[model samples]
Target: MSIRTVLLHAAPDSGFNDRLAFAVALARQSGAAIKGLYTLYPAGVPRVGRALSIYVNELVREAKEKEGGLKAQFEQATAAAGLAASWETIEGEVASSLREAVAFADITVVSETPYGTVDDQLAATLPEHLAMACNGPVAVVPTGKPVPARIGKVLIAWKPSREAGHAVRFALPVLAAADEVEVFTVEEGDTTTADSGAKLAAWLATHGVNAKHRHVAEGNAGHAITNEVQKFGADLLVMGAYSRSRFAEMVLGGVTASLLVDPPVALLIAH
Candidate 1:
């Protein structure tokens, strides 16, 4: 499906501009409108005493002030790019707010790590949380990097699972627009894996994606995929997100968990 509405997390952190850049590029490619979501967390204050209440109120005031600047920046950027844009402000938990906003978006954009101060531990894994919580695709931009102006080469991390299939289907729009697309799979001496990769590539061809299939025998799937992303110099990496149970993935340390922590490039993922 073509992207029509892009939901972007607008904040005052370092990744805000990068995330916006990525969102603008994607929206431009698909002729989509952008919606900037600015979230406030006045609920995080504890009702311990009056001193803390006053401190929390001051912090909220400062955050609100920052929101004004961020809104201006968003408008200027989107307007300069000639894209239709809108603004929003929500007061609550960031994850909960995004959960509702993503429902109306074709794709949601966010930073791979926390969007606030470095000590904001609650949001350290916001991207992963949204990836699992949302029903649609999430495009996560790398933190503190210059986002690519266009998605030229896309690398798809393939696996024979429903989540991977969903990711491929959700990423069809970007894949079709990419100049080069590769379906890369890491196998352990499994011939069937190679055959499946070829079939997936052929099927993608029917959807107007010229994808090349590649398979390698590697035991560490997470490391292998990240290394391939760097080797290929890919602009974007499309892959399935959270193929395992959250508790199991947390304890076992799967690929989705590792990559979401520190993505080497822009990532488009779905559950």
Candidate 2:
């Protein structure tokens, strides 16, 4: 689908600023409106202690000030890019708040790592949760580096699954805009009987996307995908969020978990 509106998670941190820049760049490219979301999770207060209540109130006040500052930053970035934008501040859980906002957004952008409160349980699995919570795609911006001014090269991790197809279809707009696209599938053993990449490439051609396909025999899918991203110098990586159950992935360490931990490039993921 065409990206008409982008939902961005705004915060008072370098990672969030980077994500805002990334979202602004995308909005400039697609002429999409920007919606900056800031969800506040105030510290819980008890009725028994006056001192603790005062401390919690102070923390909440500080958080509100930070949110106001972040809203200004988001506005500056979006206005500089000459994009239509809006901001929302909700007092609730991050995931649930974003889930409601994502319903109206075409694409959602977030930081690859935790944005605030390093020990935040919700931030820990944010990207995956966002992907699973919404029908749209989630763009996870990598940390510690400036996002590219343009997304030139895109790498598609093609696995024949419903989730993978959903990601590809949702990311069609980005794939068509990218200068280069590589659709690759990995095989665990030396089985050269099927080549789904070529078929997928042919389909993408109908959408005016010139893509190349390749097959790799690798035991570890996540490692192979990351290696390809590095070798190709991809600006964005598009793939499914999680093929297996989240619980199983947590214990067995799936591709989604590994990549989300340290994404090599901007990750566009869908469930």
State TM-scores per candidate. Answer: 0.92, 0.90
47 Cα displacement, candidate 1 (Å): 7.5
TM-score of 2: 0.90
Model 1 residue 133 distance off true place after TM-score fit, in angstroms = 1.4
lDDT of each: 0.86, 0.83
Give the winner by TM-score. 1
**Candidate 2 clash figure, as a count:** 0
Tens-digit lDDT track for model 2 on 167-221? 9998899889999999978986636413777889999999999999978876698
Candidate 1 per-residue lDDT over residues 154-203, each given as its tens digit: 99999887888988998999999999999999895665777788899999
